[model samples]
Target: MKKNQNFRFEKKNRTKLKIKIFSLQIMEFVTHCENSESSTTSSIIPEMETSSQIVELALSVERADTAALLGADESNIDTLEKKRLEEIRQQQISQAKLMAERRQKKAAMGMEERQNWEQEIERYRIENEEVEERQRRLDIDETMEEFYPKLCEWVGLSNYEVLYNSLEDGTNASDLNKKICGEKNVMFIIITKTGYAFGCFCHKKIPYPKKSYIYSMYDKKYFTFSLRNPSCSEPIYFKQKHKGKSICIWPNDEKNFIFTTKRFIKIKNPNGPHGTRSFFHGKFSLKYKSKDHQKREHTFFTQTTAFDVHRLVVLHWF
Candidate 1:
């Protein structure tokens, strides 16, 4: 009996110690459940509000990104328009330079053509002048050959020497005078045996008888005469009177006589002694005889009386 009671008491003490350790583990599990339920109930409304705020911030960020993309597209369109305008201005400048260069080339070609035409004209003028000079020289030589010989023959020159000698002497001069006098009909022809020639008259054949007169007054005597043609109606005569008993007389021919009275004169023919009567210068004068008057006065006093007068009259008519 005693051994059985000791074994039972020891078993009961071990069972009570295990039962206390299990009760402590159960109390720790119940405290953890109550703290988890309190934490979940307190944070439920605050969590919902924070989630709604985050969704609104995300939508605002998306709208800002879309506006930045649209601004970049507008800037690219403006830059493309400026580049196109610059390209059009550069093309217009290039075309203007090309037209200016072409105009300069055309003007230079026109000036060269005008200079060539002037040179051709000058060359033609020089050639024409040379041809004219040659033709002029030929004409002068032909004219000299055709006319020179005929001119010499017409002047009656067999040679130049005969013409020169005849001109130097006076023989041709006298012949020329005879030809001129014959042509004018002023020369009196004398048909001699050798040839025809001329004659002159004696002074007694003159009709103005007063040429042989002498004048006397107060013991002084004077003689007078004149030169004229007797056949002409206008005869020139000179007269004078003497104081002494000297008589005035004149010759009518080689053997004839004329005597003066105061108012009348008597003319005797050469063949007879009988005289004819004529009036004087209205004065009564007497006639006397003188043999010396026949030899000295009648032969030498006459000139070639009518030759110069005929020449002057013919020239006046011509």
Candidate 2:
């Protein structure tokens, strides 16, 4: 009976050992399952974060495109608005012009307004004529604009008409007499080859010349001036002293034709090829250079006693 009891005790201990081992194996299996679940959750969390980031980038790009589209729409709208305003402005101008044309046509068709229309036409014609005349005068003045003011000051007149130009008209004594004789308030401008410009103004009418070597007259309102002189910086002027035969005319002699003033100056053979010899004395003379044959020093209004005439102009001062 004791042997039987020992065998049963051994069997019970073996069974208890086997149960403990089985329990340990179950705990290890549960630990392994937990580790695998944790690894899967970690990997899935990273993938979820990456996916969320990608979605956010896509949303940002969409927002940018939307903003860009909105900006483009606003720009297009502004451009259309400007074009519409410009078109409206042009239409308004056209309408205004059409209305004016209609009004003008209506006013011109009425019979009672015929006289008024005719008067308006006459006024317009007069205005046009005045404008043309003003332009013509301006053109003429521009020809002598350089020294016109000085000439006007010397003649004591603001208005004048060029009557004769030797370059334009024939350089003859008969040509000068035709335009100048019997004309009052006449002026003479003489340009010399040696760079001297001088002139004289006569208040009395130039008389017709007689059949003689020299014809002369007297006038108190006669004066002489040197516009340009090599020796003088400013213009030189001289008034008549005794007023004795201040105007001399030559009618027949073309080559020897000249103008002279008694006790003042004598321009000999003004149109001659040998040039002219002027003797300035008393009130009309000044210390000047000479261009004579002997090169004699002379007291005159010019640098040279003998000078070739470049241009001769006669003007009627008004």
Candidate 3:
């Protein structure tokens, strides 16, 4: 009986000791869980604040773009735009305050960094000035381009050539030929031995007759005109109702009658638009003349006062 009672007491004490140890373990687990959850919550709070800051920054940038272009009076803006501008102005004021704080911080910086910042600002200013100058020149060029065609049309010039150059007698026939080879419809002004002056507008090349006199030939589309002077504004051209493709009436004695050699034939203007090599812009007059004997040889002559204006250009009808 004494052994049985001792065994039961010892078993009861073991059970009580296990229960106390289990209770301690459960309390420690609960404390550990609380600390882990607190740390996770603290980490999530900073991320949420960062996301909200990014959203605010994006919205501010969006407002700035619209506000920059809406620098006019708020009274002129509609209600929606007015509201947007008001918001932008507030954002700008805040930004200005931040800039003021930054300026204070910059003032506390070293002299080297402050000098570098000033140099950066100067570089940006120079770049802006250069951009403005380039844009000004481009605008001037565009204005001039628009003005030229209008000026030409206002003067009643249907794609007229203005020659400022003068050529005289003794100009090489070969040189003249080289210049006129690719040329089209042309105008020629001449002074006769009797001091009479006449000009012709024809196709192909007009003969630069020096010894040979220049007279009219049969051209279906030739236009003859008399000029008091070689001024473009002073032209007196013959109308089509005058003759209308008649044969030369003047006797072909020594007068340089318009005819063709075996090499070249004169005719009316060819069919096409004019060339755009130059818009001759200046004073024009007769310079020199060559002999008609060289007409077949050099396409020019050297003896007559063939009032040579500047080289002919392709005529475009406006």
Question: What total of clashing residue pairs does each candidate reach?
Answer: 14, 1, 15
Task: Pull out the clashing pairs in model 2.
Answer: 289-303
lDDT of model 2, residue 88: 100
lDDT against the true structure, per candidate, is: 0.32, 0.65, 0.39
Instruction: By lDDT, rank the candidates, best first.
Output: 2, 3, 1
Tell me how candidate 3 scores on lDDT: 0.39
Question: Which of the numbered candidates is closest to the native, going by highest TM-score?
Answer: 2
Error of 3 at 53 (Å): 99
Off by over 4 Å in 2: 1-143, 213-216, 263-300
Please list the residue runs of candidate 1 whose C-alpha ends up more than 4 Å from where it truly belongs after superposition. 1-73, 76-79, 129-318
How many clashes show up in model 1? 14
lDDT of 1 at 124: 78
Question: What's the TM-score of every candidate structure?
Answer: 0.22, 0.46, 0.22
After aligning candidate 2 to the native by TM-score, how far in Å is the CA of 257 from where it should be?
A: 1.9
Q: Kindly give the stretch of ten consecutive residues in candidate 3 with the minimal lDDT sum.
A: 279-288
